[model samples]
Target: MTSQVRGGQLARLLGQWHALPGRRRSPDYAALAAAVRGLLADGRLPLGVRLPAERELAEALRISRTTVTAAYRALRESGHLTSRRGAGSWTMLPGGHRVASSGLWTPQDDLDMIDLGIAALAAPPELVPATRAATEDLPRYLGSAGYHPTGIIELREAIARSYAERGLPTSPEQIMVTNGTQHALDLVLRLALAPAGSVLVESPTYPNALAALAARRARIATHGLALDAGWDADLLLASIRQSRPRLAYLIPDFQNPTGHLMPVDLRERVVGAAHAAGTDLVVDESFVDLPLDGTPVPPPTATFDRHSRVITIGGMSKPYWGGLRIGWVRASAPQVQRLAAARIGVDMSSPVLDQLVAVHLLADAATIVAARRTQLAHQRDALLAALAERLPQWRVTVPRGGVTLWAELDGPVSSALARAAEEVGVRLAPGPRFGLDGTLERFLRLPFTLPAADLVDAVHRIAAVRYDLDRAGRPQWREPSVIA
Candidate 1:
């Protein structure tokens, strides 16, 4: 790239973080370095791109040359950048290897059959009007470039306000809107945590989270979160205290598959332990709005996190619609800037139309949440009843919120069991799909994403298949509920 292009890109990048706002005071070295590293993460600065001279950057910003010097030195030490006297600075993506993405999102061979595979709910009704308004307002910003690396202020502010309502006081600068919870989590993993860093995770966490972490080659440490009853605080606290990892990932509120909420005290304890060990915590709160039974639990991990070290990821996919593809992270302003920079390589920015659609959910979240809770509660009850009547041999847990159920079977072969069920036309998530060691072999996950009639049919099919297996001398089993 030409010097002019590089210079302009660098300035725009810095401006995204408000670090280099053109001809003003010099940027903070630490913040500038963070932004620069993010640029490298997204391939904005390719491998071995010659960085601008420290003196030139300083002169452009009209600040002390030492600031740019320190920023370059910081990048070099972090291994994100390197320098030679004649060659100047060179940008490099953090670490060397690019871990291949895990290919795991496949559905069955049906020409549009019942998809019990994806744990997604139908789109909420409230999305209609919220979407209409965002589309109406899009023309107002259409006149400008509309790059929106920082996301629309209205959505950022809305997300932060939502966090504040949950007892985690936040500001717009601390948030970076992404395509979905997966996008936010992926960006945070790329920017804050280095590749191959030890990633502490609950046994059977959301599967996609596992894929995202694996893509970075993060060493996975699985702590078993009991699906039979709920989260094992002892396991979580001990893991955080002893692991001392670079990152501790959790789905505390209505954990995936298992649908267990870590009690408020336990949430605080885990946060405290992570903080004490100086490990960054990534809390996936995608189910924040979907407490199906009883009053929702008050367990916002970020509220206990003072430094925004606990990056809370939430999205519209869980509560609203998967197609909307909106999720965000609640972090400090500096961290938000870092995420925005890191995201560019993977995607220039999340689609504006989707962002606007999400604004619909944010605008009237309460009504949408209430309707979801009621609908999910009904579905949960229906599934439970169906399982009890048909799959009596299998043990199941009733979750308070969210989409899926984790259950243990009479024998130790959920994978084999799932294969058997598939023979009869029902595709179930095998227990081994959740656990890395295949320990949860006696378990199965049932998602309530389908309608009540379909779920009932699925349970009936599962029970009939189980009976056949039992009669044939095969002991059926399942794994723990989560999949990380």
Candidate 2:
């Protein structure tokens, strides 16, 4: 018989539970087996709880029942389960896998898993043609000793024109090419941030950015954008005033994991806020082109950067492909020189070939954007529709642009849900991985960059995994798993 957890019975047992960790010859056996034991020790699963039948789990896994029996036998021998004849295997854990009811995003099989972690669509077919065209012009630049630190004028001019079309008045003198968006951002940070100086960023913001600042030991102050609706102006201004940070980083168009787009008015206020606070503003528009809506997108944050303080970091990765490795910073002429110097030790220059590909793609951006806009819209819609129909227990808000659907799962099992999805062929990133500390443990960021068919299959697999966990008494499954 099952019994509810009462008193410190759980906390006390939880403190004493122990599960040995070891690598298994079987990838599937390793993570799950260890997890089962760990969960028992942690008191996440009370004694006498029914374990999902071995046959059912094995069927879902496409594995033999013998293997499942072996796994269960091992757990039982280790004091995890009390398997009596016909009584079925029941959780009688004091020691076992450190599986928690809330870990949906742990490792499953290192093989047979398709990772949908960062939101990036495969490159468009046209990218190859652009690379060839850029290669043809490479020979001419080679005559100049290939030491152009200010970067090839062709790519710089192209990026400047892109800004101009985006409603930002820009000139070639205001652009600098870098290895990628991160590189450009790092260079800008190197130039702008002082040791212990503060930076204003969104809580649950990009962790890489946090790591970058941490590398410099810079103090970061954050404002909340949890509404998933984008930036909150009043709180943002307060952060600006209170922290008086040296730099402010924003993804205003579709802020990373939160998927919130900072409205036009908020953008204006933030720019003014930074200017008044004597702060430098840096905006990343990496996924600006990936909205599900097929239409022209907005310009970079530099549109209101009259003081030349805002540095806009952009890349061809999202629009073109992740392998492109091409990004640039739009800043004043003086700032461009500053970045060139900062990057001398990093890499004398980005590969001449890669820059060529970016140049050619920049030439045909309009057509490329149109095709990408259509494809992403379809993929995103299909994923959202599937989630709505199959996993209504979750909440997912439709993003205007950007490749992810930031959904909040009902329970605290986002991490658990991720772990379960792995066993079922769907690899996912835990919400916490995208946030600072444990800020978003209940949220899930789903990527819709795959083709419509794959997105459909992925959502379906995710649903089946969720259903199995619920049936197995892992009912901490987020209710309304698609919480918007």
Candidate 3:
């Protein structure tokens, strides 16, 4: 269905639109056109939704109406917009630039379906034994009221000790157990960000993190990441200085989707910059334990923190299993108290049984994670090999660790490929899902969480889908079902 975006709303969504990233001054009409095009490409601006009239937008942005008209005209020429004499102009993607309507993908239940949309692994072999141990240890708390808002002492100590082992000295008073990384992030957002506050994030980051920011209606500032040049400390510092965001969310360890690990020196530089800018950094360490290669992984981002400005989020979902539902936040004791107090209005506490299970799992994490790395290495190799043999035209960066490969297709047909893969019962997430403003259409994320055989099969199915798309000159573009 077609809908209209009011001038005020569009103006807010395009915060600092005149100051394009990496530019020295305000943009002209052509630059304005490119920014709107970026919004349309990254799925932030919906296709087929009517935009505010040129005069209305000009007044809202406090610019001249002629500039808006020229920008609209440029958009029309680029095929990103359509206009009628009486109907007005609406957004649209140019030919061969189709993308998924939604960035979120739900799991499918078909027996034969090969689901790669979610980058998660099955439970490790040690889970059952750990759960049994937890059950045995549950009786000690049977007589209690079963309410520990700050989490039980046992799990908190285990998490804190784990941090200490990684060169960051932490105490149980500084840890607050939570449901998962997403839940922890939500709690941090609630505590750190005011409504409409600015936030800085890496472009092509975790999709759910984007959802969290969107939920709060936060103004997002982005720093782009690429396989060729990983994290640019100077560029990141510039973004921090320019945007002056209230909070910054990053996935430095085997960063989601891209799987590029931040160097130790880079981490220190980034932490120092954020501290200087007074921007609280929320570092996600969910994928820290799944290093498939032998390279030395850097210590947690909080290790470089001298002023307690960094909050580290860690969880068992990625390494052990997603079903555990056990995650924790490491911050200063006072910060932990603040978060725990705020969490009362949310979930009072995590499940006792799950927390108990986590206690046992953390005890043997080293052994279990070693086995997991071996398994993941095999699967990662299998996936790379299959793609090398079948889809050699596509470019893929080899990640030292992490479970996913960021694949770049020869053309901007990621959304079309995902749609076609559904026909063969192979679910895939397009590259735009990991990006902001409907960008990264030429990329796709392929996880190696499945078994070696299943990874091979998925690659075979994807190869077939690409072959069909190539044969047909790409699928016909379909209008998105919903626009918001």
Candidate 1 residue lDDT tens string, 1-484? 4232255446654554442222134447766775565344322344566777777777766667898888888778766676677867776533433311111112223332344557888887677787788789889778877778768888888888887787777899988888889988899999977878998988887777877887797889988877576677787778878888999888888888788888888878888888899899999998868887575678588888876668888888988899887888888888888888888888877777778777767778888878877888888888999988877777887887888888888887565456556556666666656656335768778888778988888888878877776444321112112323
Relative to the true structure, candidate 2 reaches a TM of: 0.75
Best by lDDT: 3
Best by TM-score: 3
Candidate 3 on 301-369: residue-level lDDT in tens? 898999989999889999999999988899999999999999999989998999999999999998999
Residue 476 displacement (Å), model 1: 18
Per-prediction backbone clash count: 18, 37, 5
- Scored against the true structure, residue 147 in model 3 reaches a CA lDDT of 86
* Per-residue lDDT of model 2, residues 1-484, tens digit only: 4644332333332231122222333344444555565454323444577676777656655567776688778677656667778757777643322333223323222455556665787889898888778888888877776766767888888888877776787888888888888888888888888878788888667656776886677887777776445666788888887778899888876777766777676677777888888999999988776655543455566777678778889888788888988888888889888888888877788887788888888888889988988888888889989999998978877888777788878776665567667666676776765555345657787877888888888888888877776445321211111212
Worst 10 residues of 2 by lDDT: 474-483
TM-score-best of 2 and 3? 3
Ranking by TM-score, best first?
A: 3, 2, 1
Question: What are the runs in model 3 whose C-alpha is more than 4 Å off?
Answer: 1-109, 473-484
- Model 2 ranges off by over 4 Å: 1-111, 294-299, 470-484
| Per-residue lDDT of 260 in model 2 | 71
Measured against the true structure, the TM-scores of the candidates, in listed sequence, are: 0.74, 0.75, 0.80
